[model samples]
Target: MSRLLALALASTLGPALSFAALSFAAPLHAQGAAAAALPKPEYLTVEQLRAKYRDPASRFMTIKGVEVHYKDEGPRGAPVLLMVHGSVSTLRTWDATTARLKTRYRIIRFDIPGYGLSGRISDEVAANVQPLDITEGLVDALGVKKLTFVGVSSGGTMGMYLAAHRPELVERLILSNTPSDPVKYDHLVMPQSFIDATARTKANNGFQDMDFWNNYLSYFAGDPKRISAKTRAEYYDFNRRVPEKYPIALVARIGDGKQATIEMAKVKAPTLLLWGNADPLLPEAAANAITRYLGSATISRVLMNDVGHYPPLEVGDRIAQLIAAYVEAGTPKL
Candidate 1:
């Protein structure tokens, strides 16, 4: 059999076995050896990433001493939607949703400093400037008076922070697959099974391999077959380019997150828990827990079946429709 077929078969055998361990034809074994000899993935400089990925809508500005990459699109005078992407994701995560909603609302999305084309967030920058400060500064720099905040995964945590601390700036909120109380539900969110798989896969395959990302994305997806090649390639490329410090920084930042129940009580905006029921990271119980803390806000919950952690990627059009309706009606009907 061909090397491609052999590799494809190996992917089904679970994380315990490495590619080199697969017993294939002599020719395929030699090919696998050749593949293993390739150099490891290298980090891309901000300038290089920008030149390679930036589009006409791309805009750059310094927020709290960190140079930020963002896009402000759609009608200038329209109701604004401020979007924040989750870890391991860039602003482009909203591409499909933005395409559908931008015609009606002004959509603003930014790379959350440590990821994407945003400037490298060194230890010095992270120490001196908080994530919330960067977000607040970005909106202030853009001259936005009020916005509907939309966040996915950890980005949703940031949204809750803003809604609690900077309530005046947030008109509405939509959080997808977000952890309400990590301190309380850490086990449910990051199960040992997932932790073990992650450690094992990274140790064996490393970040440079396409199969690594394929497995990573697949594990997060409700339906692995639904993931597109284009999506896989984008994820693989971005992961390979991100700074070495990102993983640790993200973990530390999440660990430092505020007490959710205390913070969510301060939010006054109409909030929607738009989540995927099949999400392994934040289960339905976690999504329901958010409602308990959001006592002060008008809350709505919609859990879509067969969708995963990343709703924008898994079901963008549906997300866009819900967001548009929620923003217009001032309450979610979903």
Candidate 2:
């Protein structure tokens, strides 16, 4: 009788212990799954971006269907200098140079759609509104009958597009650090490996890939240190606030690079090509390619020593002087 009773008790206790073990392990398993599901830092909002940089001012306007943000300064009657910022960058990128040119030209700088303070396009509106359309809309909204366009990187592409599509509006064109024919320029092509790496980094970090900004700044400025801590903080803040739709829109436009290049041949404005000898992204060869396509357009190349892609910011005074001289020389016949 004692053996049988002991056996029964042992069997019941064993099952109970097994159940308890499983119950205890359930929470740990769930915790692990939760951790795996956590979003990366790259997805974090611009508000969460560090405060090591800052910009001077902000302004907004209704262009087409979106609320466009811009910085307008200097005398209204003065020659217009429309400064276009690059990809993933806001109007603030032009802060250093615009300030120096403000006394001479009416500087107009704006945040392109999906960048800076500008909001995303509504789904109700057609999904086909590209950067070129938005730029044209902005010009129309500003009532700029004629002006000089100074574009950098993506902005340079937009400027070229504008000159091609709307010849009557542009007086002088400045293309800096932007490819004229992005599709034909194999060297300027962004590698799939780079894009994949960036996507992975953003997914894992919950924020944009730091390398993108780092590479951009390094390629732009001869001295990365020239980009002030305050300015960086501001840029990070603005970047963080950027809407998710911004990246989506930008990717869509990039995919349309072929169409953009076709439009480049139609541009008839007198163009000045500015490039930094040390620029890694868009090399001097790319600048020469751009100049080749501009028929009847006067191309003035200014290769700043030690300066990277962003000569305007690294050497604002010099950039302003060159621009002033070009604009004063008279408008190019379209």
Candidate 3:
């Protein structure tokens, strides 16, 4: 199959693959092979997950009838920081960063419906719903007027839409390893090798295949060694528990890149482009494109060495420091 076609297929499969679960019962060295060899894992009910993982900060509310899972942390009166995690990840991705910033800022994060502890969404429900609708509900529900908005990967795409349509609600914007236009930059955004691997996994082990996942996730880090076995297992468990239908439903609603540049041009808030220089999915070229696509008058760019796609998880302290400094510095003059 052609590269673009593979990417298109990959995009649709991306969320589903990440949401599927695995059973990692053996040691890392043994589990990688064992997971692939084992049959797909059984789905863990939301109740089970909540009982096992929910904390004091964990809260649930109805957003468009969906029981959205979210966490509100830090001082209530402090500056607000709304974080959005990318596909295949949940609010927990910000756990490390939130820990560092909670003392100073009000950090709000949620699972994007299908992932994490968020309620499952069917394809029918997702077709009529846009990510912005859910996001707006969260903001309005929390009575947040204006705040700093942060997102990674696909989550960053949601941030762009919100900043464009709800300018007053976003005091500042920060994006990391986000794609400005996925289709337009398909060559850079989804490499051929990655596409091939994705296809092979689908054909062989199916979406629940953790063998591919073990190696696939490693590619997100500059140093594969940075992602320990324990972390991979955590991701596997999270993916396995999500209802099978949610990821497919979520991907069906993802917009093509056809209108990304137009939407991005509408964002006028002060912006920070935090990119990982080593990210294979979104490389330096992708970063440059976002700068060109954004219409923000006050923009700052930071490229960290040795970091990869998931900055919050890989280098949370640094992300926290950057966010604190930038938000405290106030809006930059044009």
User: Model 1, which residues run further than 4 Å from truth?
Assistant: 1-39, 183-201, 204-208, 246-258, 330-334
Measured by TM-score, how close is model 3 to the native structure? 0.83
Query: Per-residue lDDT for 27 in model 1?
Result: 38
Candidates sorted by lDDT, descending order? 3, 1, 2
Global lDDT of each model?
0.71, 0.60, 0.72
TM-score on alpha carbons, each prediction: 0.80, 0.73, 0.83
State each model's C-alpha RMSD to the native: 8.3, 16.6, 5.7
Best-fitting candidate, scored by TM-score: 3
- Residue 155 of model 3, lDDT score: 77
Per-residue lDDT tens digits of candidate 1, residues 88-159? 778988999999998889999998776678887777776777678878888888899999999987788788
Per-residue lDDT of 11-86 in model 2, one digit per residue for the tens? 2111111111111111233335434544445343433332322245555676557667677788878888899877
State in Å the error of residue 105, model 1.
0.7
Q: Once superposed on the true structure, which residue ranges of model 3 sit more than 4 Å away at CA?
A: 1-13, 16-40, 183-200, 203-205, 246-254
> Cα lDDT of model 2 overall?
0.60
